[model samples]
Target: MRLALAALLLIPLPALAGDPLTAAEFEAYAQGKTLTYAMGGQVFGTEQYLPNRRVRWAFTQDVCKEGWWYEEAGLICFAYDGENDPQCWKFWQDGARLKAQFEGDPEGTELTEVEQTTKPLSCPGPDVGV
Candidate 1:
């Protein structure tokens, strides 16, 4: 039993997913790209990174929200139009993709990058008439 325990301890553990990305790193990786995110293996939403830290986000096939992100206390916080509270997240780069954890709860929902493209997000007007 003692030898077995020693061998187990000697085994190398797997590395962590990744470290949180800096604001500049996040911008360089996300800017000008539309990225799809998944949570719990299901599509969650999509977001488009625009110039000047502007962003457009929407649920799957839902209306878009115009927002802007800024770094606050080493976290990326987003303020959307008409929204009273800002949503913040810590972003990480996992291999070629990105991951995000809500700042309010570190063990809560985690979002993973599913797809990325240069195509602009389609935001239909709230009211369209014939």
Candidate 2:
């Protein structure tokens, strides 16, 4: 019984109708918005989506990174300017909210969109002492 239960829990969840959102669909939904993502019930970070798939991501630490996304093999992958490695994620639209699964994570990290707004993301300029 324990084995069966564990297996059921391990099964991957289908993101609405057992299909991930296509590139056009994802773009239409995400563009022109800043989305707050939560992991483990805590706000992990926020991302502001701009036109032409441009994105600015900031962690709770307040460090922002500029990047852009493209669809590859049905997964959306982001490549930041300073980061050499590309981060890929699978997105799902759950009703009015959205959910994302980080690719290559064995533990399955699911980030849920908790809040969204058209307001711009606050990114501070370089440090300059007054």
Candidate 3:
């Protein structure tokens, strides 16, 4: 069945899905949208992407950290206020959905976009009281 094996191999598999989105694609899709991210089916965080690559993120809380994203070496990286380290991630788009994989660590976190809306992310802003 050498011919059968060859035929099977020649049969084109369906177009491979889950091709990662390019930097421009990611920015266009994320901008002006508030996306809620989940991991292991539990809500992990939410981010509101604004104009000029700015963002605000909250981890299931009212407080938000101001940040911005930049495309670096085919990955999206974020820098937040008071956080010296920049977190990088790879993003993929499956149809209308977005997926994020943290960089550097082999077992780095994976976040799925569970919900999205045009609503701006709620933020208490900087602490006004001591």
Q: By TM-score, who's the top model here?
A: 2
Give per-residue CA lDDT, model 3, range 56-115, as digits (tens). 888996578888999998899999998999999989876677999998988778899999
Residue 113 alpha-carbon offset, candidate 2, angstroms: 0.1
> Global lDDT for candidate 1?
0.89
TM-scores vs. true structure, each candidate? 0.82, 0.83, 0.81
lDDT of 1 by residue, 60-107 (tens): 977888889999998889999999999999899888899999988746
The C-alpha lDDT values of all candidates are 0.89, 0.88, 0.87
The local lDDT score (0 to 100) that residue 71 gets in candidate 3 is 92
Q: What is the lDDT of candidate 2?
A: 0.88
**Shift of residue 103 alpha carbon in model 1, Å:** 0.9
The TM-score of predicted model 2 comes to 0.83
Cα RMSDs of all predictions? 6.9, 9.1, 5.3
What would you estimate as the lDDT of candidate 3?
A: 0.87
Name the regions of candidate 3 deviating beyond 4 angstroms. Answer: 1-16, 125-130
